[model samples]
Target: MTQKNNHTIARSWDEFSEQLLGFIISRIHHKEDAEDILQEVYLKSINNIDKLQEDSNLNAWLYTVTRNAINDYFRNKQKNKETITQDIFTEDTDALNIKDSFCCLEPHINELPGKYKEVILLSEIEGLKHQEIADKLKLSLSAIKSRVVRGREMLKEKFVTCCKYRIDENGKLAGEPDCQRPECNH
Candidate 1:
């Protein structure tokens, strides 16, 4: 509506954004996509600020908006797409070398059995607790823990192979382009 009213809403939104983002991201499978959707939520909220009633609960309104946005995203994709491929390697061209490294790692991750891949991503990337991952996946805690350990080991072995490093003889890392991370002291 008015400039002052818009400013108040934007300020209120800023106060709530971080907590809302964390909650929304927890439900979403992809962090990058979650961010994109969150941006859409902001734009929608700003544009519809006039429609919000004086008595409405802002927090509930925001949650409703976020949920609807997520639903719409899934619905639009479902309408267009057939079988979904594992999209482990998305375009991240800002750091070309880092993206290339991820591109190299993605195939190994994708090649793993589905359960293992899910366990690894939930544990490492999302930083979910074992119990949380277990609940989300509807598995026992011990089962989740075991899968995470096994998945990590499998990934390590695959990475070592991709690097072409001699595990026993040569203490040095391999000469493969993927193995040369600037941060790796080894």
Candidate 2:
């Protein structure tokens, strides 16, 4: 490798290693596995450094590599598993809290216009694939996809209007909603 490229890689490692490791750990509960993924990300960044455009953001590029590495790790794990176990797919507390927070949106979802309501119920609540939803509804796959997207947009608008939910700068739902209805209590 060229001296300048080596220097750039070293600099990136010094800056992003800790943050990348933390990101991996947040997704993967096992510390050892997270560390391994972090190392793989580092190696990938080293090998692919030259392919990165000169004007491209280095931080964003490294993050993309780290995310891909984490995904590969999970894919390999899934392929090797003969059967799924609760422990292997356990939901972290944060995920559970997020799910619970969305429960208040149930009533608002029902209030949506029929077309959107049907698609959202099947896709989100019933956990069906888009193709499955399309087949069941006898609609084109593109139509089903469009409905799901539009349904989510409508749902977000309802959350903002009915519940007074505000999105923060990061686009995440922020603060407690002023929900006074009995159905919104959950």
Candidate 3:
């Protein structure tokens, strides 16, 4: 690696190692396994650092790498097991349930104001990356990111107001959709 890349890696390690470790541990639970995943994230980031654009968000990029490393750890662990047990699959099950539950929010999403609806549909429903949405909509990257964030916030408000949904202690969606509006049927 070049001198600049070396410095970048060192700086990233100093800046993000602890935070990334906590992130991994939150997902992985076991200390040793979380440490292993954190090490893998560091190595992967080192190997792919060149691919990261100079203007890209480093913190976001590192978190994304760390998240992927955690996912891989779980996936490989599942692959090596002879049979999957309920305990081993709880997290994935919860994630799947969350995804399935969110499907019911489509009508609420459609009700969002025009601008928020457009970006939310593209990013959340259509699964477009923020940059891709920006490119497609002829908007600046920052604008697209801002719109996505704002749109999610609005959607959360709609969930609370219309569907009476609230995040539970574990941060999962807790409440059932009980639409308060006369026209709604969630």
Candidate 2 matches the true fold with a TM-score of 0.44
Model 3 residue runs over 4 Å out of place are 83-186
Candidate 3, residues 81-178, lDDT tens digits: the string is 21211211223334443333344466667888898899977776545788999999999999998987787667666666665667555433444557
Give the alpha-carbon lDDT of every model: 0.65, 0.71, 0.70
At residue 74, what lDDT does model 3 achieve? 72
lDDT of 1 by residue, 31-102 (tens): 887887888888888888778888888778888888999888776554322111112211321233333445
Write out the backbone clash pairs for model 2: none
Each model's total of backbone clashes? 0, 0, 0
Question: TM-score of the candidate numbered 3?
Answer: 0.44
